[model samples]
Target: MLKINDITNASSAGAFVVKKGFGAILAVTCLLGAACSSQSVEEGGLQPVALKEAATSASTQNVADKPNVLVLMFDDMRFDTFSYRGGPVPTPNIDALAAQSTRFDMAMTTTGLCSPSRAAFFTGRWGHRTGLDDNVALWHSRQTGLKDEEGGIIKRASDAGYYVGYVGKWHLGPNGMAKRGAEFVDTYKKELEEHERQGAPYGRMAQTKRYLAGERDENGEKNQYYLTLKGDYDDTQAAQKVRAGQEMIKSAAKEDRPFFGVISFSQPHPPYRVPEPYASMFPVDEIDEPANYMAKRVNKPLSQEIPWWPWHEVSHMTDNDWRESRAHYYGAIAMLDRAVGEIIQTAKDEGMWDDLHIVFIGDQGSMIGEHGLYDKSAYAYDELMRIPLLVRDPDVEPRVVNRIVSLMDVPVTMAEWMDLKPDGAVDGDSLTPLMLKGDSAITDAEDDALYAYEWYNGAWFGLRAIRTQDYKYVWNPGDERDELYDLKNDPGEIVNQIDNPDYKAKLLSLRKRLELRLVEVEDSSVTRLQRLIELNS
Candidate 1:
């Protein structure tokens, strides 16, 4: 495992530079350009300066010369799915990208739900702060999107003279993506509207109702409800989204403005509908169970008492059934990998690869038989929180970030790269310092810890977590099932150390850290934790 101490100063590295009478500036010197020297502002000011030179070069460049941003998102993808992570799946495309990118192995989302995670990714804020702390159901149509004054990443890029486009999953509301500042918007709203117009069942809820009503396809398969149509791989929702992204990129190439396109894939989420060879690619018999598969849920939160969904409950699944489901899930990832290769190849063909800042990430992960859980619920386990985050900036060298980072940091990092102003104060920090300077770059205490929360999962049993590299502490407000895990000793999180006398000090320290973060984010759940802290004090 890579640690902060393992990272050495490269020929091209970033450093913090402070000028007299002026505020401290974290400058990334000797990037894609020539090698330059960098000095720490703490060590006192140095003579060498390259930021001004880089800024001058940038000011003279045209819009076409500016770097384009391409954000590709996956749904419900685990961190260890790709070959880069030594998982079962062979994602050659993603593997190649990871080899040339900064892989955040410890990347986590603010929430494990799709809507809330994506909302944080866009707004650079926590889910509860944005009023999108859960999935958007029919009653959540009023959850709309970020206000114009609330400058989101998309709006910031648009304001910075980049032609922005968004295609595929935007779960903030019914038509959130369409109302964004995107010049080209292609989401599921139109498809659902057309389905409703034709008097056909639309949306996941309707599909779930139809499946529960004993509706089966010609193949007599009851689990084919997730796909609106199942024929060719090209006709699948994932492929359609990729094609839309390609078209958007191609169209943006014709314009004089730089492009910022987001292509979100809904595949590998559930139902695992991969057509043709992909479906048979991963043999079910060869599939193996996860390390923590069917592990006793002792000392875990009570929220794991039930499965996430009715149709895919773990209780109804046998050993072979679990293997088959896992195989299908791998097949879905392989299928999505092919689609990813296509979109990236399209960008390269259009000459956008040279200057494109690419970001590939999963909105959040799901429990694939981890601790006997099928899907994501109100749990802050490693399986549900750990996501794949690969960032390939043309200017920054490729490396691995071993520390924990949040999905909300995506927008803040991009804003720093593009020099765009966000709406207001954000909970996330720019990752440039970490990417360019490594462990020494983390000057703030907040950067050393990652926080996650889940408010709804059929109940209001709030779960707030604070995790560092060595340990993880989960606070179950108003519940007695709070958890503490020594990650260094038990990475699988099977042994909860909350009750261990040896870990009492560690638990108290983590609880205080979590309380501070909750107060910082203005989360109401912090009240109960605060009272508990007072009692302990």
Candidate 2:
């Protein structure tokens, strides 16, 4: 990681000494130039300090010029939800970004959950390294000397003289003023006990009670509830969080140094709550059921053993309930999209549009009735593993890469764009070369198959999967069973081809490939244990 020493004698007087009219002219020229070059800048007229010859020369004499970075991340947003990806949701802001930026069609997450995925993103390492493999495990790992050695990307930027600010949902530890634990039963009990002891809102448990109990005034509105215990599905809370994020962006812009602002929104997760106008954005009669709406576990060759509560629960909901739920979900997405629009607009209003590098992605994907799953896990399926990754740099070519990439590539990619060295051992290679080459080398390269693992919810030890362009193979070490799917034929993963005689050889080869990768990345505890079990057997 890059470290900076305090310069006691730094003179601020020289930093702003541009000849009056010349500064104005330069800013205007850069704005106009950027506006003419791309639709991204044209749509939002925010131009940061341009890195032109004059600006470069000015910076040589004790002046500093760094690009502002804004990361917009949504919670529980499925990879297929965006309109750009041909999903049902009409995310215009995200679509516009995809149209004008480098969109990675196969950005796999290291883990399929929230904190673990975000930890991987920030540390440029997998879940095991960050000790955040699962929600509760994060705390346990922290106590056992398995601390997050890497302070994450935000801390890195901050250390490098960039003003850093994080707004909205921070699921990574310290409990976010919420007691951490299981969902309803044990976690809630512990939280309530802590709340009674502390006599205030201490953790998520208290926050849930406060929100649901309607303790806080909703902008002084008599009947309006300011907070709700409905998880991220509440659009009213989502909107307020969005508004808070906007204020953070504005504050970051006021900093003298370059800023790195992360606006993380929690929404479209569960409890399916939305405010009045947005709550009813989509009508029940107009809502369309998911393509695999009535899919059954028995139809799957893998023979589903785990009971998925949300999917099975939502599956039994009446058509009206489903429609209302769908409406609320879509409305939540729209609310998030509008929040993105607000941030973009604010950047424009601040005249820092062109000189900023923007990245938009999801913390983790939500399974809205795909294969009868509602949220993400380490299942290694496409819906859970794949995430939408879009990056917009002022000088890069705007194109989409269908080649496989991982979320771990994010920090390195951003580092490359900023001309900075990455802070740690990056598990993912930068996509810059492919971005520059376009679709020419995209199909030619033999990219490593994407991998994902999870150790959460007292489920299984871990689940591993390897995905190629046309084929995907999954291994559950605990069960000693595997699943294979020809993605070209079954994109929804409705069938398992693991036992097919014709593909038997291919399955073994893919299994070895996945095992070797697990060994290479050192992400396979179950694989090692499975090996010992096989030897004993």
In candidate 1, how many Å is residue 269 off?
0.7
lDDT of each model, Cα atoms only?
A: 0.62, 0.51
Considering only N, C-alpha and C atoms within 3 Å, which residue pairs clash in candidate 1? none
Q: Mind giving the per-residue lDDT tens digits that candidate 2 earns over 68-108?
A: 77666665566776678886678897687677688778766
Model 1 residue 215 distance off true place after TM-score fit, in angstroms = 12
lDDT of 1 by residue, 283-317 (tens): 76898887788889887776678534444344545
Cα lDDT for residue 384, candidate 1: 81
